[model samples]
Target: MKLTTCFSTVRTRMVSSQPKYELIQEVGRGSYGVVYEAVVKRTRARVAVKKIRCHSPENVELALREFWALSSIQSQHPNVIHLEECILQRDHLAQRMNHGSSSPLYLELVETSLKGEISFDPCCAYYLWFVTDFCDGGDMNAYLLSRKPSRKTNTSFMLQLGSALAFLHRNQIIHRDLKPDNILISQACTPAGSCEPTLKVADFGLSKVCSTSGLNPEEPASVNKCFLSTACGTDFYMAPEVWEGHYTAKADIFALGVIIWAMVERITFVDVETQKELLGSYVQQGSEIVPLGEALLENPKMELLIPARKKSMNSHMKQLIREMLSANPQERPDAFELELRLVRIACRELDWDT
Candidate 1:
């Protein structure tokens, strides 16, 4: 068959059995699957479809877990990426065919499309795909890199991020894999706009549902280990407890600290030399420290290379970041406390007249 004919036939066969969604383009790719931009034909709405590479049991379980978790917490908070529906692509259509009974899960996309932008639309016969409110501003990692940071810009982003994390914590969700790549900006806040971006936490692949009531101090370490000892998250963002075979909501706080540092310093923990130095400094100090910010302030090479300034982050922000980055997880503030502090700072900064 010709290329177009083959693609059409495949699309038809795939959509007939599965929920019909128009595949616009590939938006993201990870170890587990490829995420695509699709549209719901019926609603003319945009959605994100994560097609997992069905190879292992662990991958399958994680995919299903994410779906279940998102479904459970769909209405809990506005900042979370809502789970619209779960989809299963036919086993035959998948790259790896399933011989016995098996199924896949499709997640609802959460981004919106832009105006005056036209792409290939399926013929009327095909099923209408779903669309989310597109985030034209892209992921936070990309957003930070694109900016020429100053004290004001760095502080503003940090405060906004803290607010988002606080909201998540209020809902009792710990985003285990908290990093720049997973943070997305709403499409409504675009280039040359004065409006602040509606920051939503995307990719609940590694999230855990904690209790909003309070931490269960009596809960056994084994119980905690059962849920957290898997060593499942990104290496750079992993907290000390995670590395030592224990994890909790505080791990998320630690990650938030790493993220703030990355935004202000425009660096990641992936660099071998930098990671080694930072880890050494953190271990030696035996307490929370903002090594990246300090490094940026001290090194002339770094000062010329990155726009981050230590003076940019006000004392309140610095104190908050240090609390989150506390080496001892017990010393770190819970999401609730962090949110309260962030709100106070925001109110003061914006002069809300409250």
Candidate 2:
């Protein structure tokens, strides 16, 4: 069967004119919506359903924007969370029935099955639903927190993250929110079902699409000239330009740098007091300008310094990371360059270790 046909069959099985899918339990919650683990009546497919509460115009707009954005670029890459279908609230059913209709559904339907049996009438009317593949491993934030050391991020994980970011940037989409909480792991691992996880970038609620016309290929500047005046990201991951209301794709790059720092150093951005101190030192002491790489390396015992026992990272990796984290947006490497650099490091790491 064709891929589209398979997806269509899955959608029909998951959603109907009546409410057939049973909400097994709550999976996640956010300011915008509550996610539930639901199962389809016909096909018995298990899925994650995100239902956003539309309290205001802004909330509705955010929901619509996210839906459209995901729809527009669905399944562009394996590293991105795929959108199977979007469920718009059925007003007809809402007005006629006392029970509420599903509104603004973002579904990730996984192919896994639980042992429970669900009984539903074939003739009963059901509300419309969105279907998507369910990722059983859960979000990166939960995974990282579950680790024994709490902050021990491995090298392979970082490489996978970099690859996901590269895919997002290639599509001219900037995931404004690139925190650990937004990355999700797939259920499929290794043969023993225990391997380093593969990550997918989720939550496009804060993402912005770059205009192709004004984008400068040579310069690192994006064509998205519309000043994103509204500050919408987490405080710690917010780039300096983001606070200044002059964000571009570079802002996402900045966040990626913070993520890399977190994975390597096993520290939160807010917890890095020494980074703030060093930047402040540059302002106060009137000292000769110090390179960020040198500054970070100098303070080996500093709480915020990225832990590098022997500075094991190769020169290329260091240089790439430095460029990504550059304070000046103009100096930062674009997404393509960042991807190439990361791929090289990942490949080299594998070669050297072998």
Find the candidate with the highest lDDT and give its number: 2
TM-score of each: 0.65, 0.68
Local accuracy by lDDT, each model: 0.53, 0.55
Best by TM-score: 2
* Global Cα RMSD, each model: 11.3, 11.3
lDDT (10s digit) by residue, model 1, range 34-82? 7777675567577676666434444554554565456555354445566
> Whole-model lDDT for model 1 versus the true structure?
0.53
> Model 2, range 1-354, lDDT digits (tens) per residue?
011111222243233344545677777776777777777656778776676544444455565456655766645676778876655442322211111223222120010001122122223332323345566788765666566532224566766777777777666677787777777787666788676566778888777665455455554334334346656676556666776666677777777776775565444322243342110111111534432323333442223222333445455656676667666667787777777777677766643212
